[model samples]
Target chain A: MTPSKQEILSVAAECFMEQGYHATSIDDVARRLGATKGRVYHHYASKIDLFFDVHREGMARLFAAVEPARETEGDGATVLAAMLYAHALAVLENHTFESVVAQGVQMHRFGATTPGQRSTLDELIASRDHFEALFKNQAAIAKKDGSLADVDISIAVKTMLGGVQWSLIWYRPNVDSSARTRANLAKQMVRTLIDGVRTRAALQQDKPERRPSRAK
Target chain B: MTPSKQEILSVAAECFMEQGYHATSIDDVARRLGATKGRVYHHYASKIDLFFDVHREGMARLFAAVEPARETEGDGATVLAAMLYAHALAVLENHTFESVVAQGVQMHRFGATTPGQRSTLDELIASRDHFEALFKNQAAIAKKDGSLADVDISIAVKTMLGGVQWSLIWYRPNVDSSARTRANLAKQMVRTLIDGVRTRAALQQDKPERRPSRAK
Candidate 1:
C-alpha cells in the first residue's frame, strides 16, 4: 500500500515480463528501482509475494474493466464488443504483463520448483481461470439467446484467447499505429468470429477484392 | 547420419517436447535413452545443438511429406487437402519437436544467444516461408481458374500455421480422436477455404429453420 512498494511492484513486473521468472532475480528488481535488496525485503516477505501481487493486480484490473460491459443490458454481440474493446485496451496498457503471463503459461506446463515460481504459477492460473469464467458465462448466455453461434466454449475460448494473447507477439505500438489503431483490428476479429472470415454466405460469390486465397 | 546420433536427437526431441527445453536437461534425454552423458556429449556438442538437430530433422520431414502434395496435379482445393493432411500427420508425429519449437520462438524473442538457436530459428522461418510459397502459388492458380474464393494468402498462411502449431499445446495422441478424425477436420478446413462458412445466401434468408410465410 505504500508509495515505494507500488513503484517497486511496477518495475518488477516489467523485468519479470521481459526476462522471465527463471532468468530473473530479486536483485534485478531492486537494481531496476535504484534501491537495495534490503529495501525490497522490508516491503515484501519474499519474491513470491511480489509476483502474486502482480498476477492478482493484472487480473483484477482486467476483470474490473470488463465487468461493467458484461453486466450491461444489451445483446450478446454488444457485450462481446464491449469486453473485447476492454481487452484490447488492457493489452495495450500492460504490454509487459500480457507477454509475461504468456511465458508463465509455458512455465506452468512444466511446473516450477521454487516456492516463488510455484506460487506465481498458481496465482497466474487462477487469474486465467477467472478471466475465462467471464467469457464462458457470456458465451452460454449468448448461445441460449441465439446471439452467438453454437460452439464449444472450451475450444472457442482457446481460439479467442489465442488470438488475443498471440497477437501481443506481433503487435507493435508505434506512433502511427497507436494502441487505438491496433485496437481497430478488433473489428476484424469480431467480424471473423460472428460472421466468420470464411462464412458460407461470404464465399458463395467470390468478392473481387478478397485477398489471394490459398488452397493448395 | 550415424544411428546413435539420430537416436539421440529423436529421444532429445521427445524429452524436450514432454518436459520443455529449459526443464528437460541433457541428463534427462540420456536417461530416456538408457545411456549416459558421455554418449550424449560425444554426439551433440551441447543441449542447444541437440535441440537444433531435432528441429531441423522435424522440419525436413514435414517439408518432405508435403512435397508430394505441392506437386500433385489437382485444383487448388485438392492440393490444399493433400497439404493439410500431410501437415496434420507430421504434426502428430513430431508433437515434441513442435512444442519445443513453439517454446523456442518465445526464447528467441527473449534472449536465446547461441549459434545453434539462431540457425534453428533461421531454418524454421525459411521452411515456413517455403511452405507458404507452395500454398500461394496454388492459391493463384485456383483463383485464376475460378476454383477457390478470394482470400489473403498472407493472412491465410498465418491462420493455418498458427492453427496447426497451436494445436501442439493441447493435442494428445492418447485421446479418442483418431487420425481419421483429424483428417476429416482438415478436409473441412479445406472446404471452408473454398466456401466461406456463412455465404451471402444464408445471410439473405428471411426466416428461421422452421418458420414459413403464410403468404397472407
Candidate 2:
C-alpha cells in the first residue's frame, strides 16, 4: 500500500538527515516508504519538489508551535521566554525536518539542485524573517519596558535564536530519557537565554553594566 | 613543484565546504592545488586524514584565541565576555576550516565514511570538550560571584557557544565591510550574550520590574 504524504516526509527527512540531500534519491525514498516509484512520483513531481516540501513543512511546524505564544498576554520578556521554550521543544521533537530546514538556506545560497524556484525560496525566507521579527519586536518592547538591557536587537535576537537552534545538534533521543525530561532541559536553556538578555535592573535594582573592562 | 601541506589543506577546505565531504575527493583537492595526485598522497594518506587534520587545526585556533582570557584576573563576567569576543573573531577568520570541523562530529556520529579512525574522532571530541570546559568554568564562577543569576551552567555554556559558532553560518568576508567592522559586530553580539545570563543585581542598583504582566 502507498504511504500517506506525512509518512513519506517522515521517512524522507530521516534519509536526508542521514545521507544528506545530494546523496538521497527518489527511489530510495520510495523504497523506505514501501511504495513504488509511481506512487512516490504521483505525490511529488521530482526529488527537488520533495526536498522543498520538507523545508516548507518544517517552517510551518515551527510557526504553528510558537505563534500561539505570541498571542498570549504578557510582558515582552515573558512572551519571549515562553516562545523560546516552545521553539526549543519543537526542535527536539522535529529534529529531522528541522535539520533539512536548517540546511535549506545554505543550500539555496549555493544554488545547489534547487531548480528555478525563486518564489519558493523567497517565501521560505519571508517566513523565517517573520518568525525572527516576532522575537525582535518583543525584545524591543522588553527594552522599552526596562526589562532588557539596551543592546542591539539584531544581536540579541540572533544569539537567542542560535542557542535554541543549537539544541538540535546535542539533543539525542534515547530510551533512558523521557520526553518530559528532554522538554525540561530545553526549558532550562531557554530560561538562561532569556535571562541573559534581560536588564539587570529587574533582578538587583543595580546599574546595568555595558561592556566590562578587559584587564590589561 | 608541489604545494605545502598548509596550502593543500586550505584548498581542500574550500572544496569540502562547497562540494561536501562525500562528493569531494583527493583528486579534486590535487586539481585545486594545481599539483599531481602523487604530491597530494605524499602528505596525506587519504581524504579522511586531511579532514581530521582540518578539525584539529580549527580546534587549535579556537583555543589559541580564547584560552588567554581564561587566565585573566577579573570578574568572571568580564573574562567571559572577552573570551566570547575572541572566539567569535577566530570563527570569522577561520570560517572555512571551522565549517568543515563543525560537520566532522556530525559525520562521525553517522559512522559515515570515516574508517578506523576512532582515536582521531575521540581526540577531536576531547578537544571540543576541553574548549567548552573553559566557558563552563567561567560561567560557574560568574554565578558564584553573584554576577550571574543562579542558572544551569551547562545550559548557559552551550547557549553562549552556539551563538558564537552560528557566526560561521552567516558571516561572509566582503569588501563592503572591513575586518574591523565585522569583528566589532561580533564583539557587540558577544556582549549582548554575556549580559543575557548576568544577574540583574550586578547591573541594576535601581530594581527594574520583572515579568511585566500583560495589560488586559
- What TM-score do all the candidates reach, one by one? 0.74, 0.87
Query: Candidate 1, DockQ to 2 decimals?
Result: 0.16
Per-residue accuracy of model 2 over A42-109 as CA lDDT, tens digit each: 89998878888998899999998998888766666677777888888888888889988877776765
Model 2 regions more than 4 Å off: A114-119, A175-177, A197-216, B175-177, B197-216
What is the C-alpha RMSD, rounded to one decimal, of candidate 2? 4.6
Which is the leading candidate under TM-score?
A: 2
Q: What is the CAPRI rating of model 1's predicted complex?
A: incorrect
True contacts kept of 1: 0.07
Per-candidate DockQ versus the true complex?
0.16, 0.38
- lDDT string for model 1 (B1-216, tens) is 233987888788888776666667889988888888888999888888887778777777778777887776665555664675577567766677666666665556665567856767777667756766876776666656555444555444444444445556555656726868665544443333233223333333412432476869
